[model samples]
Target: ENFFDFCIHSSGESEIKIKLFFISWHPLIVPIDEIYANETGTLTVCRFYTKGSLKDYIHQTKPTNSAYWKRYGRKSLSRVCDLNQIKNFGRQILEALNFIYDNGLVYGHLHSGNILFDLDQALPIKLLVGFVYNLYF
Candidate 1:
């Protein structure tokens, strides 16, 4: 449930958006400026700016079938997906996995909660978060 959240900018100058993640592996996370660990607390928190997560793209829609009804129960937060979208999503995920594999790292956490996306740019990109287990090649 604990994931990246945008940080509030207190500076008067134009500030870049920042995100915070707790107890994360440095390699798996996106490029970060700093990693601060609190010695007084048992949990470790990491602060960095990320494009954002796939959760931003989620939108509520009416269910169209029994399967959707069962899965979503009337109203669904899952947006209407087309074949191209599904294919693109699959390709993005595959590319992410390939990148990890090429870097001699294997990601064991593959789930919706771990999948993050950047849809604001001209060409949207997806990333996998929550590196609970990673194996080196």
Candidate 2:
């Protein structure tokens, strides 16, 4: 709950935005009112998202189930995807980290599951980047 609360308030400031921009270029890092909670301290109201984490997308690939690759099989899907896409993903992650580090904050937990896919957009990566940007910055 504390983490979620921190994320909510953290995403609301301009300073946080600058910090986020420096850390991760990825927009998914932006915080959202995806999840909400009631706390016991002075800050009783909190908001966050329960939708899911990025790790879900990264770990989608499974040895037995090649179908998972359709979503995020980094290697096996190379035939259809170019190196640029892969590089972009990596860059986005680094940007996110940079934002966290620049602000003296630590993501603490990171994985493919934490990364999420935005199905509504033509480019999911762009959408996620925007989402994260709005949330934290």
Q: Return the top candidate by lDDT.
A: 2
lDDT of 2 by residue, 1-137 (tens): 56545664545455444544444433535443222222321111113333333344344333334355454545543233358866866676676566655566556546555555443543344212222222333
Per-residue lDDT over 1-137 for candidate 1, one digit per residue giving the tens place of the 0 to 100 score? 12211111121111211122321233334443343322221222234325444443453322222363454454545676689977877777777667655543345567653555555654355454434222322
* lDDT by candidate, in order shown: 0.42, 0.44
lDDT of candidate 2 at residue 3, scale 0 to 100 = 57
TM-score of 1: 0.48
Candidate 1 contains a number of clashing pairs equal to 0
Model 1 lDDT at residue 8: 15
Give, for candidate 2, the lowest lDDT window spanning 10 residues: 37-46
RMSD vs true structure, all candidates: 11.6, 9.3
